[model samples]
Target chain A: MTTSSIASPDVDAEHEQNKTPVSFLGPFCTYSHQATLLAFPDTSKWVLEPTSTIKEVFDRVQSGAAPYGVVPFENSTHGVVTFTLDGLADRAGEYPDICVCGEIYLDVHHFLLGRRPPSSSPESEQRSSGRGGEENPKGVPLASLSHIRRVYSHPQAFGQTARFQAKYLQPLGIEFIDVSSTSRAAQLAAADPKGESAAIASELAGREAGLDVLARWVEDREDNTTRFFVIRRKETTEGGYPPPEEEGKRYKSLVSFTVPHRQPGALANVLDCFRRRELNLTSINSLPSLVAPFQYLFFVEFEGGREDDHEGRISGVLEDLEKVAERWRWLGSWRRKR
Target chain B: MTTSSIASPDVDAEHEQNKTPVSFLGPFCTYSHQATLLAFPDTSKWVLEPTSTIKEVFDRVQSGAAPYGVVPFENSTHGVVTFTLDGLADRAGEYPDICVCGEIYLDVHHFLLGRRPPSSSPESEQRSSGRGGEENPKGVPLASLSHIRRVYSHPQAFGQTARFQAKYLQPLGIEFIDVSSTSRAAQLAAADPKGESAAIASELAGREAGLDVLARWVEDREDNTTRFFVIRRKETTEGGYPPPEEEGKRYKSLVSFTVPHRQPGALANVLDCFRRRELNLTSINSLPSLVAPFQYLFFVEFEGGREDDHEGRISGVLEDLEKVAERWRWLGSWRRKR
Candidate 1:
């Protein structure tokens, strides 16, 4: 497979392209796996490696076993997946060859599933019957948020539903339960016949567990989506391939840093460099630097490839910031997501 | 409430000297409520304002409805509670009124609750026989992880148990379920019998539902503990609160800011001011600015009261950082957790 096949017909016609094998964490059923499949669909054409953790996937991609890997970057509800960020930060220096090539957006859905509803009491049966199917004989209706007493879902699902849980369930005396996955939520509801319990999972999971649908799109926002990154190992091009000249081509660079503890205006001084250089930052987030309990590690993704701009301009800014930063790493840049 | 009557002599005597009320998000039985109760036992005298959400608790303290509030800052398993961070960031300008006074650590325990084990099943009989003379049959010991198809707990609890679930249950095809609270996990498990499902919750919650304890401390780490913050809505006095200052007194200041993207060393420049002035930063976290999809708001807590240090030094640092920041706020300063 070549870049020509994947690129848009209207773009530079002679641009050279290469297909790289990609890997991700998966059993073929997870959202991460789905992202991987979506990012690179021709499994047979490009080597597809699936690992068990985000670190393993990164290692594989960095080691060249697979040229690229896909992993979840962050979820709107769950914040950042620290493991992925940490792995990238830890390997940023050694794997100067790696860069985030693209990103994908996935909509998350939580469902409730179970084998059967708990056996109903005589009173429950009469009450449900009178409600004309609006309520389960022993189970609660999927739409009746108030009747729910317990809810089960994966941590990611729970995060996505955080606002909903706070608004409808927490106040209504409902209990939000956490499970390993949405499928597990379905299984638990299926195994029980209780009317007071429900699970947040996927519809497919509900089918697998023989559970009733309790709710759909229970997230705080209707536009619920998770962003994933596609990272590829750095490669040095041979002399035969021609370089393309195009203004539209773009790359994203990532960096991590820790600032001096006693510095009052450390972060501000750092931002000034960007303002003066006219560089556009796409996104930035800081997580607790796992190595130091109270310290922080910032992950920043910005527009423009490092090589596209003046080297002195970037170095000059970095030097000024270094006085206050305990450490810093410039993750390589890559073409914007295709 | 008089400070003299509420101070505890058993622990640190100094912490008792300047005791104050703490509010939290709750309806009396929630985890945050319990955590607050444990951290501050003198409920009769110290005000315990239970609000509907963590934001409410923060607001109540900021508005002076209560002097301080105890809120769940983060979980060992789940990274950050975005809502809490967002709330704190939203009120960054009030830094002079609120500061982190102390931190609390608590262990989490999970349990299973259900109806009396049915005597007809061999598994039920085995569980009953193991009870050692108890009339009620205890929960049946799981034959294997594979026998468990579904599990439930609160979202935070589920995140903490991820390693355990992946190790023992994922291969066996166990699914996780999310619920509002552990207590509700017990209620749902109690209501269901035929399903091969269980709830991950506190033993106290199980006992309340008349369910047998199937497991305890089911998290990956036995030392699993959640840290809570005691934030006061008052500025610290200058000159270190005068002589005869209570022992173990530590001060903290909080701030928020946004900076230009992609400029190298932007953060370093901000830190330079602090390093030149000699202020120690305690903690920092960044949350997505709710108003903008890509922008972020950073929450930083550091040592030294704003008043203790002359306004010139602090304001000078702020002025330098302000050049690169879209907006910034000073939350306030107070003694560290006593």
Candidate 2:
């Protein structure tokens, strides 16, 4: 937001000298990076920083190193990113000020990315020369899929493209290489001297790495997407949580809690609170409580924002949870992106 | 069960000539292979066969190519294995007879595996000759982790050992090579001639590959365990499904279903059926329905099995589900393995 320098003295004064920073989990060309860019498009107004891990993304915002941070929360194909959920739950008390302010829903696309064989290369020479239907952004004909020996991508990427991998690569006994990120995979694939290696990564990453897209839309499902949380440190004051930036936008609230494992119907009771209010729970996920084997820390998202709690329904659910749950936190509401 | 060939003329006759085939997901040394061995300890009575993928494991069992198949159902750390879940849900119609008969819980452990530096190598000479605190199975000291330029592993292995990786390997900016399986990672690590590569795999895999265990139990959590399902084709007769071989045991039932997305409390109502009966839900997970964007297919595990439904509680729940859910499948019960 372009706040008036005269009206906003404290916040604008710091940003007048240096740009406002936004942190994301990245090497570069990763989905988190893309989400960050999408969240803050004004490069002149914002400085984008990439952190090594999801923890660092939270830490940056928590430590006030950055005002905003973006991290992947879930994917349509791969259900949840536990690290992100766990970080949010664990730091609920100590980092109470940091909360998700918005969300980014990105349509994820994985491509078979690799270096194109040079014209003089034998693999190119051995091609059937029948590149009729295929065309890539680089305008170079892709080498035959048979020429590729190994594939590289993050584990989630490998999982997302299971159907494609089984159909095209399994019979050939091609080795699948997993990396930390899709961008890293692209970088590794590009470093292959023989052009025999491929990466399942974003089209942007492949182009940046100077790799060719061997195959497009390689994910198991066409509707593959990742949801990202745009977290910012709320200006907590004696007034409590700040008012919503957009008053009328429909929002989704995320709350994390834990219940005693020995108690039967405890989780169901907590859920029943939402059901009774017709809150419309969108997602429910759990991570190990870490204290015991069967214990879990649960996260659930519902349709209404704190501001939208006109009937005091969200507060009522929290009140019900007080009795059913051991610990809980209202991890701020965000406008729905999808 | 060792049935006399003379008593059982039909089933035991073919098995007498040839051992029953037990299929698993493997390249050897995989957790699935280990589980298969655990499930069928009588080696003479069973022939263990390794399949390339989980789908193949199901295919073999459905085709009767293998009488029993062992597939990983879930992990404490990673939650559900969606591929395994989806396979069960989809095959409910065509492979109605196949159902989960048993479960195996394997404690998962990851090791930092690599080749030791040769005694004559320069790196070994530079070791200060002060190897005291550490010793490996091969009786050779591990070269410093600094010597490892790249680490190979399945993505889940990388995820499981993220704490260790972040503390040590991340600082070195060591490249991660992801493979199809942990066993494959061990194979790749062992092939490193310079001993400059490491793999995060099982101790069995590392030892079988002739690699030294640099570190033991590198998994981030102590309670890391994978749950496997022993699936077998039921012998359906004109009368009905047969009775359980063992009568009174604590059993867990897995059921798969989908509720209409348009309905607000569709999922909560389905869960209410179990809650009202005090049937504790051990786990709940969702996967994209593939039909549309927001639609999901859900899998839930509860405390009771078919025969344990003495009061017809489970059947009553199923009857209730038929009204709430679009489709449902009672995917058999298995004795719980902690």
Candidate 3:
């Protein structure tokens, strides 16, 4: 694996040769959109299509509007985003032609933005605003969780607010609001009364919206990161592993399956198959099987490629899984540009 | 081993027996407070103080103000609430006697609320209160995701809002706000301009707050249940597991451990010990370790009472775990109510 960043022209040429346009959910500034750009900066020409759901990204790709799509797989703060999981499981058939070609790791930064100094920190900005109080009117202290009346942020930011709420807001009476994106949240806070509204967004968004940073690093954990999947409607190359046919490449595969409900040890049984075959499971996510109550669909990514060393074993496992699963899909296997 | 509700009297007796009041996070309406009451209904007689943070709860217990506390452990939709995890992991020494006794499950229901009638249902009591020709005449159509300028909910509710936002609001350019609880969200939404703001909260809360239900079951999945843990400053009951001493009773142990980062087989190694010992693993949750980056803390619930199990085998497994774990805590071994 090369550590050096792959140049955009080279990645564009590769995507052009593959005849695929990567699709992802975005209006150009959302986190997932940014991740897609980061992962495939030079993939021919990129299209920015607004989607109401992550599945829409996949749907557009399956419909051939684009040959590939990008969706958030998981976050360090929140677990798997179920929309991505259910979309893959529901459209398993369409996705078999699509594989997780690569993954992009991006750190999520949450900020508190407002037009005026928050009640918690009244002084520093008051000096600039020319409002002088007898006592130093400190800018509203972001540390005072009680001072926050309403919190605004993207759903992702909302997820990150879990710890802060549990630790601070839940006790204090602060309220949280969800926004389309951190940027939008910042925009709302800027437009609203700064005293009563605060946005949990990105520093860039705060600056862009002319909002001051009231607090930084509001996520429960400091190491907030999100993982994005680069998905393409292509079968695993001749040999299952992400083909190294081109330089600057890394490969990953995405697979989905539904397991029987109320049957004890169903998960264990499937896991046993992997254990018996000595296959390594990288990550496993389960979403409610939308078709019925109690049923679950699992999306699993593992270390080996479907067409490579463990191909036969995976096929055998799939055969066994078929008996228990109502639906299954092999999304794709593709190499990522580093 | 008795499946009996801990009514007020029993709770009183337990408080007398334990000599500590029970403190939780609530104003008697929040789910956590409700869960606390359900877990120990007589808590009112036993200093049922309400505090804001799990840390505060732990502190009250540690300082001898409260003998026990209840906090949310995890939600089926969102993973573990990290504050509770960190409070437990970071202050293990202060809470040495604290152990998980049992679990309570709560289902999450999100509802949209407003002050006006449904726009489509004119001639009905549900009349749009706002200006006509706009998308939302009764305020904005609560269903029009874009018209929603603000969203409010508990942090946990915020966590669950990811799928909702990704599906409805993100593309529509709506924003979400976080409150301390669903009830609070309802309260704020009811008081806000009907068309401009909506909340993701419980139907009951909306009704209590005199708001109309705009939407229900907004969560991505229906089985959105949250599990809470009962913690007390008491050691495991003697002879609480196995054989005649505790016949007809089942026992479960909760344990927390940190696995070495990047170790492929570290988790498998721990599970292998139980596999070899023929111990059944019931439930397992893995969350990012609060103390370190790139590390994981696993909360595992398994069969058997620690005291009744073979001491040598338990010790041996612990010894082996120490090699792979940076820190580990045997949370508790409790006999389950039959």
Q: Report lDDT (Cα) of residue A217, candidate 1.
A: 52
Model 1's alpha-carbon lDDT is 0.58
Q: Each prediction's TM-score against the native?
A: 0.62, 0.81, 0.67
RMSD of 1: 11.2
Off by over 4 Å in 2: A1-17, A89-98, A115-144, A171-173, A233-248, B1-17, B89-98, B115-144, B166-177, B234-248
lDDT per residue for candidate 1 within B1-338, as digits (tens), equals: 23232222244445533555567865444566667766566544455666655666776777876776887876544456665675666532443456565566556554443333334355543231124335432232333334456676666676556555655666776655556566666677777666466777765556556665554456645545566776765563322222244444556677787655445555545556566666666666776554444455666667777556655666776776677566777766655552
Native contacts retained by candidate 2: 0.29
Candidate 3 CAPRI grade: incorrect
Candidate 3 chain A minimal-lDDT segment of 10 residues = A1-10
In model 2, the clashing pairs are: A177-B178, A178-B178
Each model's DockQ score? 0.24, 0.30, 0.11
- Candidates in descending lDDT order: 2, 3, 1
Give the best candidate by lDDT.
2
Superposed by TM-score, candidate 3 places the C-alpha of residue A88 at a distance from the truth, in angstroms, of 4.7
DockQ (model 1, Cα): 0.24
